[model samples]
Target chain A: MTDGDVMRRGDFSNGWKKSFQSLEKWAWRTAVDAAVLLALAAALAAGVNAWKLRGGGSGGLPWAGDWDSYVESKALAAGIGIVTMRELADRVPSAVLDARPRELYRAGHVPGAWPCPAGDVDASLAEHVADLDPAAPVAVYCDGAACADSLEVALELKARGFARVGLYPGGWSEWTANGGAVETGETEAAP
Target chain B: MRRALRIVLLLARLALAGVFLWAAWGKIAAPDAFALAVYRYRILPSWAVNAFALWLPWIEVLAALALLAPGRRWRAAGAALAAGMLAAFTAAYAAALARGLSIACGCFTLRADAAAGGWTTLARNAALFALAAAVFADAFFDRRRRTPSPENP
Candidate 1:
């Protein structure tokens, strides 16, 4: 057959076959390319996140800067003894801040400790903090290590500019453990 | 034709990359939640779930970035890797559906927002698989064009 005849006769079928083959090849190639793109993207994102997290450590996630700052401030306050946990047995005659529910406090508390549940401390600070001499030490304690009530209470106190706020991290458990004085009544001490 | 194919391939790569990057971020953001999702699938052993949670996102991210790189060979390798992951995910989802298990798909979010007992998850995975397939096809076609053989006659 002449080249022209062959080209015409084979044009449709041959071209169709070649096109199909090309398409098949293209589909396979694209699939491979996409797969690689996807893998690399995932790896980079994960690596960056992991690295940031690793660097963060106990400092907290990069997203919550405010939380980290708050934690740091509390730590500093606690470290400087400006905010500290006072042992009920110490009886240093400082302002005793109880960080338990009022009902729990009524059931019992350190004899001189005042009810200052962490939740209410923020709202009632004007009433409670006013009762204590600004210069006098403020001992904040909660239920125990398992409870973060004292930390919350201390944070509030510090925010309110109470220079002498203290967190008794060991709270009621420590008080009872040390055979500290206890009072069980709803007597509201004058602030 | 080559330019058109390249453009289509690039678009596919971007879409796949975006999906993988989002998935990885979601998992990394809530590793515990991802782990829970993995455990719910009941495919892998409980011990492996945590490790998968930790490493899978990185693998996906690496593959996505590699595909976007300038080197053609590296891009081809990346396409293969990504296709493998998509295939694995598709299989896992398919298996879960077959087992009649209601497991959350920890793809775009750590939170189980999608219905686990339905075809939606499977459909999403299938779409991803299709994209990977397209990428693979493009690379293969490009390679074939470059390496012509006497069989063409």
Candidate 2:
């Protein structure tokens, strides 16, 4: 081989070594940066969530408080049924549930309606229904027709073998707007 | 040619950052609602759901901020993070589809009316995945071309 060709080959080998070394360095640097980014993000999120749960200026997460009373109300009910405000007013023994968070439920709810956050429905429904007959009518509502919590709770009640579960489509907003009897508090006192 | 490629890379980076920032805002605003949405997916266990919801949005925000920062190293790190996040999402969506779960995308909106999970959701995630891949490719593939010359420096 010519002398120039030999030198060119040697140079090519050096170039390959440099490229590989640069790639290795880049990979190492990228990995370290990624670790830092992930740690910072995780720490920030955890801090915010902790603050929120501890009743930060934003008022204790989105909806937190009075879960026990809500569950107790559900347990005390005899049956579940769907009804409008007029129907609810007409039925003497119908058990009412506000299927939003305790905070929203405490703000205003159908008279004698107990808070039942939809998230807790699956876990708490069976115990609540044990106190009631399978055929008793129980009605549940949330924000309004647009909210899905009421429907979800109704389905759970039905699944739990409640014979007469019902969903009040209008929920809290409709009840208040129509001048239906309303109560606001953390207690689940009798209707 | 070089100028055009540089512009393309910059645009891709910005587009990724913008999309992620917009998504992070909604989730961060209503973390409880987002946690419920994540729970509904049934992919992660119940105990993991709230924790995942709490952390995911900040990760998106931080990665987006990094992607927007100048310099190849920062851009590379950001693109990798973005791609990794998209890939995780795509995998989760695919798993949900395979398991026949009816749920919402919960990607951008916390509203109950958010579109139900379906092929459309999968396709949307896949498109984002493609965009993330493009960002990653542009960031890493042209390192030699992007190297500063004495004249440019």
Candidate 3:
């Protein structure tokens, strides 16, 4: 080949080398940008969730719990201090927390029950009773003795530094059966 | 034909990203409930449930963002990640079905009321998996064509 042709070929090789370098740079930039964006998106989502858990955002039902298995062991462990409807009525525990779903609470709950559904009790409790005195008496119940959610809430409360959490295992069924005062409306606390 | 193929791939990428983002929001909003739903699957170890519940949604958001990011490499990586996720989901669903363990899919909603079991969930995952694979393949081919070609030069 002529010297001119070789020189032209050398230029072409250099051009390809430059192109490859730019391509590598572009790939690296895209990768870093993508990683940053992804991290930002994740952080934002986690922050919002944390805010909701802390009662900063308007509350909504997290979801339903159709797959839950009512275990007898949970019921036994949950019955740490079972309260009767009579006792609950006569004493008027510091807080009456309904562990049923928000729909159930809205349908009808103990007149002053705080709707702390078991589906997302960790968040609901923060939303409903974040400021309640943990040392004070708290009563939790679910749909009925058949429903194990109340026990779950009671256990959660105890774990959260609640000093005197009680389980009313008979739940809504028992309460309504005994002609207890019932209120139906939004699940929020009374004015 | 190439142009049409590119359009279809772009649409597929957007749809996958949208679905992932939507799914991530619900799960992220209710991690505790999601964790419980995961536990019901009885697949992962007990301790892993909470951590998975906490991290999976975030990873999904990340993957979705990566899928729509501007660049073939990012999109391809994202598609591969998405494909991996769908495969994991399909396997979990299959395992649940094989064991006859009736449970919720916990896909879009954390609600346990919507018990998603059986072949339908598996089919849905399979379809999603196919789409992700297509996106990955398309991205791979597109990147190859864009690369410096000796003969073309």
Candidate 4:
């Protein structure tokens, strides 16, 4: 019989009956297989993705790989150098850009550091940059390696046409670790 | 064997429906979290994510309900819809994996903290896909068996 003829004979009600009849035969095995196969596929996919993201290339997305290259190039053009806490202290004349929150900065900071929180860097950097020479080195730091505020502030500086934005990746923890000079009295909070 | 298959089919249907319902409720209740999850994937445009956040849950709920219904056509249609959703989710998950982004999976919520990563999410989706495939396969095979022989014709 033709496909159309078969369907016509069964119609909707009969079709349901037929479908259920087969369900009686293989429901358990089919359900088990379906569940197992799906679970396996999902697990494999999740594992691979997690690895790739943590691998890190300019924010973890593969398509955005060129971002690191861009950041590096900008860093070079801006004469920004990422220095360790010791290196930053050795260069006493440099200005420090504290990228932590205003409250943290007010509580304590590197002796010469200015309170420029990371979130406000893009907006506030212009006024500060206007006062300083673009070629003059500026050091940026936050809490520590676990924190990303410093990197973000550095990127913001780079974007704002400032060429000399140094990132102190070790940040405040490192400064304290290395016995760098710190000022404890409350500093004015950044607006 | 037929009886066993029927039990399996029923279980599969219920499981798939349950997942859809859970996911639908999640997205509907916490759209912002879902939107953020979509944003993290970085696939869809911001505008599209907003629109999807509004509508996707209802579609999922309806499809789940249809799949659980007894009508053959409704079951088939629901299976198709479920399969399509599963396929889309699979592709998105695969892409996210390739990109190496550890994003909160906004499957049920728009909150970043609510996101899950690693194998569990993938396994969950894969299980759903398999259920959809089984439903379709069962329907197809059942129809074939019910057909009369040429000699009878």
Candidate 5:
């Protein structure tokens, strides 16, 4: 090759090297920045969630992932009929039981749900759900699929000779996720 | 003309920032609902859904703030993150649509509605991606223009 050609080749090789270095630098810096931003976000989110928990704003997110699981398998094992959002909307159960804390129920719950938290199912049932006809189709739900309170309530209803017991696996979380209208405040506390 | 282009880019970037803040607000207010929305996407495992919901809004907020940072590096990084999220969302939407799943987009609101997850969402995401690309490209080219070439220097 001519002298000029040799110089051009060297220049081209150098340019390639420089370009590769620039790309490597850009990737490295961007990754570091993204990681740092992610860590900062995680820390901030943790703080906010902790604060929400303290104030009871987050409700009871006892289980994450499969939040709509309704502990479906458990409900099935107990011979409880499954309820989908579609079916719930179509039928609109005669009685809807909110198997969550009174505060969470007050904060935001399925419309027409009567609070019958898991801790005092018997008392809650007697106090809140006693008036409803057990023979009528009743739907039970709680925070989300991860919650077992709905199943507990459903099973309890069956034992109490409730003829029609259906379990809404999706629960409040699913309801909100599906854009269902939520009713806040007390739902006429039992006297 | 260059000044006009710069102004357009600036406004677009700001608009993106506003959208991000708005989206983050809904999610932050209703963490449970957001988590359920994420679960409905069905892309992530149940174990990871809550964590994703908890931290994703924060990431969006930080990225939006970075877009407004004074430094070029921060702005570029922020755009990169935003672009990455949009690309992932675009793909997810496409996949879900392909599978014939009609769910809420959860793009902005925590409350999942039937109206959100239409084919139009893909178009919206594409537009947002273009905005992010413009911001990122501005930072990338600005870097190259400011730095002297090794051979010349």
Candidate 6:
């Protein structure tokens, strides 16, 4: 090839190379900016939320019984004992009342748990569980942290003269998540 | 096309930024509450929930800022990131819906708003994702045709 042709080809290639280099440099700048922003946000969030970060799900899942389960303070103050998965597994309560809605209870629940919706806590317990002694222990649960039905049911049970009312704050979600035995289609026997 | 539709693009960018900023505020304020909300989704593994919560809102903040920032580089970067986030959110919401989860959306607020994530959430996020992707594509291709800016890289 002629020197002139070679020089022209080199110029053409250099043009393309320059364009690509410009695009690549722009990309690098954008990436660096994004990285800086992410680092800043991470640092700020980590700094601001350090209190929660240290103990909140940082170590691992909120599993193993102590999963930052947001149990209401009043329930604890009212003498309701918090029941962990370990406790529930070790010693089954005499009455394991599922405080979730009937539909949810039927979907799946802790094996042997009886249907007792939160709204119908008073009447349902009275009607379905009237045969049980008031002094007997009763454990209640609902839909874990997102749910308050368990607390309501526990308080109702407490007022009903159930001396031992254990509150399973983790509820059905925790049970299923931790591979606890699940029962569907309703348990035939009342707890 | 970008030049002709510059006004429309600007408005789209603003709307997405506004949504991101609004969503980020509450989560940033209450990391613990948002963490719990993330847990409720049941889609993310138990371990990643907190870290995901911590990072997501802040990324949202960055994307919003980038969209608002001047310069074509910022615009393209912001749209790309925003599209990715919306895609992720849409997928999470769809998963929750498919799984029959009835938990709070944890979308706009940290107040444990009872408004559940459902088909509506999926649809809205899908729409937002489309907008972001469109904007991103426009920025991406439009840059290819233009001479590089003389500003320092």
DockQ of each: 0.08, 0.34, 0.15, 0.05, 0.37, 0.14
- After superposing candidate 2, which stretches have Cα over 4 Å from the reference? A1-17, A59-191, B144-153
**Which candidate ranks first by TM-score, i.e. highest?**
5
**Residue pairs with backbone overlap in model 5:** A65-B46, A67-A145, A70-A145
Sort by DockQ, top down from the best: 5, 2, 3, 6, 1, 4
Per-residue error for B121 in candidate 5, Å, reads 1.3
Candidate 1 regions with alpha-carbon error over 4 angstroms: A1-191, B1-3, B112-114, B147-153
Q: What tens digits encode model 4's per-residue C-alpha lDDT throughout A98-164?
A: 8899889878898767778878875556644447766667788888756777777887877777676
Model 1 reaches what TM-score against the true structure? 0.46
Ranking by lDDT: 5, 6, 3, 2, 1, 4
lDDT per prediction?
Answer: 0.64, 0.69, 0.70, 0.62, 0.75, 0.73
> How does residue A151 of candidate 3 score in lDDT?
84
Alpha-carbon TM-score of each model against the true structure? 0.46, 0.60, 0.52, 0.49, 0.63, 0.57
Q: For residue A93, give model 1's deviation from the true position in Å.
A: 56
lDDT tens digits by residue: candidate 3, A28-139: 5445654665566557655765677578864322323322343423543444465556656765588888888888889888877888887688787777777888888888
Per-residue lDDT of B1-153 in model 4, one digit per residue for the tens? Answer: 779989999898888888888888766555444554565576875456555554566567766876787854456556766877898887788788877655556675443223346567788778889889788666544544553331220
Interface RMSD of each: 14.3, 8.6, 11.7, 14.8, 5.7, 9.4
**DockQ, candidate 1, vs. native dimer:** 0.08
Where model 3 places Cα greater than 4 Å from the true spot, the runs are A1-191, B148-153
RMSD (Å) of each candidate, 1 decimal? 17.6, 11.0, 15.0, 15.3, 9.2, 12.9
Q: Which residue pairs show collisions in model 2?
A: A79-A136, A79-A137, A79-A138, A80-A137, A80-A138, A80-A165, A81-A138, A81-A166, A82-A166, A82-A167
Count steric clashes of candidate 5: 3
For model 6, what is the error of residue B76's alpha carbon versus the real structure, in angstroms, after optimal superposition? 2.2
Which is better, 4 or 6, measured by lDDT? Answer: 6
How does residue A77 of candidate 6 score in lDDT?
A: 68
Q: Candidate 5 — which residues are off by over 4 angstroms?
A: A1-16, A56-191, B112-116, B147-153
Give per-residue lDDT, candidate 2, residue B15: 86
